[model samples]
Target: MTELLERCPVCGKTDLREKLQVQDRSVSQETFTIVQCQACEFQFTNPRPDAASIGRYYESAAYVSHNSGAQGLINQVYKVARFFTVRRKVSLITKLNGGKQGRLLDYGCGTGHFLAGAKKAGWQVTGLEPNDLARADATTRVGQPIEEPSALGTLAPGSFDIITLWHVLEHVHTLNETLDQLIRALKPGGKLLIAVPNVESLDAQHYRQDWAAYDVPRHLYHFSPASMRQLLSRHGLAVRQKLPLALDAYYVSMLSEKHRSPERAGGPLTVLRAGYSSNRYAAQHDGQYSSVLYVAERGA
Candidate 1:
C-alpha cells in the first residue's frame, strides 16, 4: 500500500474516510485506496502517484496513438458511423452556443481526434497535451504542434472563445490552478466544456473498487454532479448545461470486469452481452454512469 501525502486537492480538507481498496487496473504491481473527503464529499486517491511515476504506464505503444491498429471491416464501418455521430454532437454544441467559428483549445487532447474534428468544423483549434508521444501525434494530425498550457501566457487574457477538457479534469495535478488558467484563457462569454466520471452513477455503486472509471492514481479526483457544479462556481464559472455521457461506461465496465477476474471468461459473446446490457441500463436510467459533460460560461 502506498502511503498518501495529506491534503485534499479541492477543499484542502484533511478529514478523509477510506472508501475502497483495489488493484491498479493498468499496472499490476500498484494498488490504491479511494478516500472520501468528509468536508467536500469528493472521492480521490490518497498518496496518488506523481506525474513522472505515472508516465511509465502510458509509454506503451497502445497508449501512444488513438489509431492503435487497423480494425476489421465491420469495426471500420462502425468507426465511420461513430465519427458521424460525434460530428453531429459537435454540431449540436456549436448550435447551442450560437455558432462554431472561433478560437478553441482542447486541453489533454489525446491524439487530437476531437481537435481534428473541431478544426474541420471551422474552429481555429489548438491543443494542450502533456504526454510527449501523444502530443507529437496530435501535432502531426493537426498540422501544428500542440502548445503546452503553461506556454499559453502569450495569448491575451480571454483569448479563447471555447475551451474544452474531455475526461481530462480529473487527471490534472493542480486542479484549481488548471481551472484558473482556463478561466484566464477564455474570453468573456466564452464556453468551457468539461467531461469527467460521475461517482454518483449506479455503476460506481455496483463495481465499487472494481470500477474502471475510478482509474486510481492516474485519475486523482472523482467528481459528482453537485461537486462539479460547486468547483466550477468557485472559479467564476456557471454551469449552463449538463448531459450524461453514454458509450464510455460500456467500454470501461467491460474493461473493469475483465481485469477484476481475468480467468473467468465464458467467451467473447458473454462479455459483449454483459457490457451491452450494463451500458443499455445505464443509458436508460442513471445507474453506474461513466461520464458527464458540463458546459459553462465565464461569470460576469
Candidate 2:
C-alpha cells in the first residue's frame, strides 16, 4: 500500500475524510480511496502510488498519451477531438496574447500535438513530457526535444509569456511545488492556462463515482473552482477568467459511460445523449463544464 496523504496539499490541513474508493479501471484493477480535507475542502486520492511507483500505473499499451498504438473506439474519438481542440487552443492563445508571437511552454505535452499547432501559429514552443515513448513521438511531431518533468523548477525564471497544461494538472504528484515552478517560469503579466477535469460538473454528478475523470491511481487531485482559487491565491496569482471546454463535456461523458461498467457500457447513441445533456448544462452556466480551462495571470 502506498503512503496516504496526511494533509491537504493546498491548505496543509491534516483533517481528511475518505469519500470514495475508486478502482483503476484501465491498467491496475487496484482500488484507491478519495479523501476531502476539512479545512480546504480539497479532494485527492489517498494512499496513492508515489512518483517513482506511479509510473507503472501508466504502463499500458492502451494509455494513448504515451502509446500511439493505443487504438480503439475511445482512442479514435479522442484523436478526432484532439484535432479540433488543438485548433481551438491556438485560436485562444492568439486572442489572449493579441498576437501570434510569444514564448509558449506546454507541460505534459502528450505526443506534442498542441505544440505542433502552436509552433505553426508562430510561437516559440517548448514542451515537457514525462513518458519516453511519448517524448519520441512528440519530438517527431513538435520538431523539438521534449524535456522531462524533472526539469520543471530548473527552467529559466520569468522566461515564458504563456504556460499551458491541458488536462494534465490532475496527474501531477507534487501539486503545489509543480505549481510554484510554473508560476516562477512565467514572465510578468504572463498567462498560465490550466485545464483539468471538473468534479463539480453536471456530467460528474450524472455518472457519480463512475465518472472517468476521477481516474483514481492516475488522477491525483480533483479540483473545484473554490479549491483552485485558493491554490492560485497562495502564490499571488489571480484567476483572470474561467473558460469551459464544451467539447470535453462530450468526450468525458462518452468515456464516463464506458467506465460505468464494461459489460453494460452504453452504445454510441446513449453516449451521445449523455454528452449532449452535459454540454447543455454547461452552456447555461459558466465554469460548469465537465472539464474547465483556468486562465490565471502573474502579477505585473
Candidate 3:
C-alpha cells in the first residue's frame, strides 16, 4: 500500500512542488517522487510505501542499521566509522546532561551499539527497535530485552532523562504523534537528540537526486536545519545545538558516487575529494554537514 501526502507535515502547507524522482538503490529499483513544500522547504517522498508495505523495502541486508552482520567493504567501513561515532555520541550525551548519569531511551536504537556504549559509561539504557532481527541483535548486545515501537505509548510521563532518535525520525510515518509521545516520556528539560540527513548540505546539492542519503522510500523525508527547527518548534522543542556527523560526508560521498552511472561513479580519490569539499563548505557556511545531529530540549 502506498500513501500520498497532500499537505506538508512540517508547516501543514498544501502548496507542494515535485522536486525530483529518485530510485531506491538499496532495495527495490522503483522510482519515487520527492516533493517540497514552498512554505517550509520540507521535502518528502510522496506516495511512499505506507507502514504496512514499508517493511518490505527495508528487508535487505544492505540496510546497515538493521543488519549488523552484513558483509562487504562498505559494511566493514561502516563498522569502523560506527566505533568512533558511537563513542562521540556517548560523550556528547554525557556532556549534554552536564556529566550526570540518567535514564536514557534510545528510540530506534539499531542493534543497540550506542546503548551498549552508554551502559558501559554508567547510563541506564533502554532500547526500542522496530525490526525483529535488529531488536534481537540489540537485545544480545545490550544484555537486555529490546522493546518495539508500540512501547512508546507505554512509557511513563517524565520517565527518561534523555531520548534519542538517530536517523530514525525520517522513517516514521506518524511524525507529530511520535514526537508528542517522546516528549511526554522525557523529563522536563530533558535532551532529545535527533540526527538526520541535511538536504541543503553541500554533498546533497553536489549529488542531487543521486545522493545516497536520499535512500528513496526508506528515508521518507529530507530535512534541512530550517525545516527541522520549524517541525520541532511546533512541539514546543528548542534546538540547543547543531552538530555535524563529521564522517558522514565521506560515507555519503562514497555511496553517492556508487549511485551514479559507471562512467560517473568516479574513483576513490574523487569520493574523498567530494567528502572533503562538503566538510569544508559546511565549515565556511553554517555547520550543515551531510548529516546533522540536532540537540534539542523539551520545555520545562
Candidate number with greatest lDDT: 3
Question: Residues 107-181, candidate 3, lDDT per residue (tens digit)?
Answer: 999999999999999999999999999999999999999999999999899999889999999999999999999
Top candidate, metric TM-score: 3
Instruction: Report the error of model 2 at residue 225, Å.
Output: 1.1
User: lDDT of model 2 at residue 67?
Assistant: 76
Kindly report which residue pairs in candidate 2 clash with one another: none
lDDT, residue 179, candidate 1 = 89
Query: In terms of TM-score, how similar is model 1 to the real structure?
Result: 0.86
- Kindly report which residue pairs in candidate 1 clash with one another: 4-47, 202-287, 202-288, 203-288
- Residues 193-251 of candidate 1: C-alpha lDDT, one tens digit per residue: 89899887766766777777887777888898878888888887899887766666555
Give candidate 2's TM-score: 0.96
The C-alpha TM-scores of every prediction are 0.86, 0.96, 0.99
Candidate 3 deviant stretches above 4 angstroms: none
lDDT (Cα atoms) of all candidates against the true structure: 0.74, 0.87, 0.93
User: Which residue segments of model 2 deviate by more than 4 Å?
Assistant: 262-264
Sliding window of 10 residues with minimal summed lDDT for model 1:
61-70
Q: For model 1, what is the alpha-carbon lDDT of residue 63?
A: 37
lDDT of 2 by residue, 17-57 (tens): 98888878888888889999999888999988888889889
